[model samples]
Target: MKEVLVLGAGYAGLKAVRNLQKEVGDNAHITLVDMNDYHYEATELHEVAAGSVDKNKITYPIKDVLNNKVKFIQDEVVKVDADKKTVELKNSGQLRYDYCVLALGFVSETFGIKGALDNALQMTDIDQAVAIHEHIVETMKKYRETQDKEYLNIVVCGAGFTGIELAGALVDERPKYAKLAGVDESEISITIVEAATKLLPMFSENLANYGVSLVKSLGVKIMTGCMIKEIQDGRVMYATQDNEELQAVPGKTIIWTTGVSGSPVMGESGFKERRGRVIVNDNLLDPDHDDLYIIGDVSALMDKATDRPYPTTAQIATRMGAYVGHAIAQRLKGEVPEPFSYNSLGTVASVGNTHAFGLVGKKEYKGFPASFVKKMIMNKSLADIGGAKELFAKGRFDLYH
Candidate 1:
């Protein structure tokens, strides 16, 4: 029987295993290795951080999702030898593989902004989200005793999807935290700083404008064309639109969601990279090796329509995994694989309970209806990955106002 080893049980890796099981059947031995036993919903991390949803809701056990079809190994991958077709585990012995899939996802890019990495919190996973939630709760408690205005300020150091989403969530949770800590809602402040000239620079200008307006209406300050010079304890230094350097803005908490880079393992493996992404062929396989496949955030699939790489999202990663799974199964049967192509349906971003922005199939949606669509998308992902019962258990169908 052929062996398939998938590293990093994330969106892409899990999807790959699912499709591979369906195609290859009981003959092939499929193994999934991951550092964590649970698979986290990366998209809902901002909501988890804001306390809008429980952390457990955004994560599902890999064993539960995979059942017995694929063997689950809860171990970190220490090294990969593509040439030798072997993977060295942190504790477990090295395992050889007939084929390997690298879907290690991405790490937060601090861009070397001084204290940004050491001081600022990130929204990468469920644990990070929980940490942000706990930090906010603790900060609120400290503010009640000292009444330090800095404790009420939160600076989100990016205007991208993660930064914008977190800013909106923080704004929504401000009143809840204020009530819980016996403080006034007016005392809390949220600010977003973006190095780009406009928020959501990837989106259409009209949509970007609408998103900025919706967030601004939620009492979040959106500062565009601002470059962060320094991030120190209790302050953030930046350059203003006027090209003049500015002093640090006092804030107790700073969240860095500026950028993302591919995993170090890719470069360590001697794969050709551009901006930390492996340069793969159209089939999402490495040009240097035939047995190696890359997908998700670590793989750069070019968008022929735009002449650039596709944006890294869960939707794209899931779709890529399906492709890789099917292709690998074909290869196992001594057949050729098809090239990978992306068909973007659209995107949606939530602002608060009843506000969202969406661009779906050339149609624009906003306000309450868009929020409804966004919630449905979230629920659908849960259902697709786990099941209806898992979605219910995760409390993702909650329509709490």
Candidate 2:
């Protein structure tokens, strides 16, 4: 039987395994490896960080969705020797594969900024998200004891989609923090520090402005056009264009949401990559090796229309997974699958649970209506990953709230 080794049980890898197993059946044996036994929704991590939703609400066990044809191994992937067709795991020794899928996911990118990785909290996974919440809670306790206002201040060091959503979620949780600190909600400040003057480039200026305004109206402070210089302990140092002198904002909770790069395994495995992302060919195969297929955040597939790579998102990752699954199955049957293609459905950004904005099929949605659509989109993604069982279990049914 063909030994198909799939690395990482993320959206892309898990989806590909499910599709391939269903098609290949007993013809091939699939081995799935991941460090964690459970899969969490990467998109909704902001909610987890803000304590708006429990981590369990967005995570489910990997074994819950695996079938009999696939063997699931919970372990960290160390390296992949593409030339030798072998993968090294932290605890499981080494494994050989006839075909390999690299869907290792992303990591926090510090962009070589000094003190960023050391001082700022990054929300890349479940543990980090929970850490942010715990840090905030502990900061509140410190505020109650010392009555330090900085303990109640939150400085988000990015205004991108993740940073904006996180600021909004923090706003939603401010009341709880206020109660913990024995202060009014207004005393707990949430600030977004953005380097770029223009924010939310994903949507039209009007719509993006609307989203920003909504977050700001909720008492979140947004300081755009301020380039971050460095992250210091309990402070964010930045320099604005108007004044090159370094200015500082003191806060107990400092979050780094500037950006992310693909898993380090790509570079360690000798794959040609930029910022841990490999630019895959039309077939989503590594330019140097046909046996190796890359997807999700690790693979950068160019959009011929815009002459730029498609932004790595859950939507595109799922599409990549489904495509690879079907393609591999066809190859196993001695047939060729068509080249991969993609057309995005739309993009949505949620500010807190009740406010959202986005474009779907060229239709602009905002306010509570957009929020409903956003939740539906999230539910749809969960359904695609885990089907009816997980969708009902961890799905977002609080659409009306």
Candidate 3:
């Protein structure tokens, strides 16, 4: 029997394995490897980091998502052996495979900013988000007891999707946190500092202004064209267009959500890449390796119409997984796999629990209407993975104004 190995239990990895299992049942042996026992919803991580959502609500047991036809292995992939067609695992030794799928996710790229790696908190994973929430709780308690404004100051270091969402969620959550800690809500401050000329540069400037307006109304301070120089000792130092020298923004907590790079696996596999991402061909296949395929954050696939790569999101990752799975299945049957094409139904960004903005089918929506659509999209995502039952179980059904 041909052995198939897929690394990472992310949207791409999980979906690929599931689709492959369904198509090539009893004909191939499929095994999925992930370091985590549970698969967490990465899109909802900012809410968890902001202490507004429980981590349990965003995660599901890995076993719960897979079937008996596929074997699951929990271990960190140490290295790739391309010549031998084997993967080096930290605990499980080497795993040999006929076909390999490298869906190994992303790493938070700090851009080599001084003190960032050592001082700033990044909430990309479940553990990181929960840690941020716990830290915020402790800080709020200290602020209540000592009446120290420093303890309650939160400086989020970006204005992109993750940074802006955390900023808005903190706006809504700080009051509750203050109540829990017996402190005045006015004592808390959440600021978003960005180096860009304006927020959400990828989208329309009007949309960015809309997001800024909403967050500003919630008491968030937006610092545009200000570049963060360093994060250290409970203070973030930044520089402005006029003042080149760094100025400090006082805060006990600094959360960095600036950027991400392809996983370390990219360098190990010796794939040709730009900006640490593999530029895959039309089929999302690694042209250099017939036995290997790339997907999700690790890939840089350009849209023919725009000539720009699609943004790495859960939506794109899940689609990439499905495409690769179907491609592999077709190849198994000695047929040509279809070339991958991205179809974006819409994109949405939540400002807080009660408000959001998105472009759906050429129609723009904001406020409760957009928020409602966002929740529906999430619910539909859960249903796609584990059916309607999973939707009811993990879906976000609450509305807080």
TM-score of each: 0.96, 0.99, 0.96
Tens digit of per-residue lDDT, candidate 1, span 235-316: 8888876867576767888888887887777777667886569867898988888888999999998888988888899888
**By TM-score, highest first, what's the ranking?**
2, 3, 1
Q: Extract clashing residue pairs from model 2.
A: none
lDDT of 3: 0.84
- The candidate scoring highest on lDDT is 2
Model 1 off-target regions past 4 Å? 244-246
Clashing pairs in 3: none
Distance from true position, residue 215, model 3, in Å?
1.1
Candidate 2's C-alpha runs over 4 A off are none
lDDT of each residue in 1-401, candidate 2, tens digit only: 89888898889998998898889857788999999999889999999999999999989998888888889999999999999999999999999998899999999988988889989999999999999999999999999899889999999999999999999899888999999999999999999999998888888999988988998999999999989999999989999988999999999999999999999999999888999999999999998888889999999999999999999999999999999998989989999989999999999999998998989989999999999999999999889888889999877788654
Off by over 4 Å in 3: 399-401
Model 2 CA RMSD to the hidden true structure, in angstroms: 0.9
RMSD of 1: 1.5
Between candidates 2 and 3, which one is better according to TM-score? 2
C-alpha root-mean-square deviation, candidate 3: 1.5
Q: What lDDT tens digits, residue by residue, belong to model 3 across residues 1-401?
A: 88889998888898898788888757788899999998878889899999888999888888887878889999999887766889999999999988888888888879989999888898889999999999888887787788778888899998888887888789879888778667678768888889988666656777767877888888999888899988888988899999999898988888989978878778876767655678888888777778888888888888888898887888888899888888888878888987888888888888778888877777778888989998988886777655566778988787654
Query: Relative to the unseen true structure, what is the C-alpha lDDT of residue 290 in candidate 3, on a scale of 0 to 100?
Result: 80
Top candidate when judged by TM-score against the true structure:
2
